[model samples]
Target: MEILESKEQKLFARNLICVGIDKCENGDFCGRIWEPYDDQPFKFTGINEMVIHMDDLYDEWNYPQRALNERSFLRTHEMARTNIIRDDGFVEKIDRLQKMRGEIGTFIVQVKFRQHATWQGVVVWAEENKRGNFRSAMELVHLIDHAINKGLLIK
Candidate 1:
């Protein structure tokens, strides 16, 4: 496990994002991405599309679960009552790690710092057991893209 130096840093663990690549025929990942609160993982066909989804998750995870639920209160009473969702199970699944890994490729992204509206963190290419640090969201994408295209280390 990675060690971070600040009190707020511990919170990053729950917000980690997992990407499981089901297809990479065109050199871009095509698979499902999971966030801590999602009842189900989301499917995407390309890196650009996946990044968009991840960005949304990044925004949502920045808030406390209670704050997220309170935001739901802004919806109409019926909608709010019906839309209550708990991420406890989702959190457990990710904590176990790679139970959601895909057949082709898998990445566990830990976005430790969110400054200048971008991410700075480490990504683990789980299949090859390789790790790399990224200074921005784009860097993370490129790191994964490069690994997929150049070929992962053969086990």
Candidate 2:
């Protein structure tokens, strides 16, 4: 999968919710995609967390390694593609294509899906890209509200 970082906010087709308004150690706020449609909690620091979550998803699917484009899955499997969001309101798309089979090893490879950047501006890109369908979104909101009410979302 390919990753990208940009100040353009229209980069992603889906927008996650701002569950926690708390800032990180760097004074930047974080938004959690509580349910990234897969029941796995996806937390991203700024926008790069999108990459982190996708990478984790890759690991969960391949088990021990990420999907290596034409060298990861078999010829009959479908490619996995998802559009990531950018801080500038743009889209950063990641496409994982055909996986290769029958080669094994235990060396861990580090994947880089982000670029270097410093906080030079403030746009609060989490203004859009609302995720999930109607019912799902409502369920998420209700769940988070319940959690917050029960002191589960905040301490």
Q: Best candidate per lDDT, number?
A: 1
TM-score of each: 0.68, 0.23
Point to the candidate with the largest TM-score.
1
lDDT of 2 by residue, 105-151 (tens): 00011222211211111111122211121122223333323332342
Task: Output the lDDT of residue 5, model 2.
Answer: 22
The alpha-carbon lDDT assigned to residue 3 of candidate 1 equals 19
Superposed Cα deviation of residue 148, candidate 1 (Å): 1.0
For model 1, what is the C-alpha lDDT against the true structure?
0.64
Residue pairs that clash (backbone atoms under 3 angstroms), model 1: none
Model 1, 39-124: lDDT tens per residue? 58899998889877776565545422222222334573322221212344554655655556877878888877766656777777
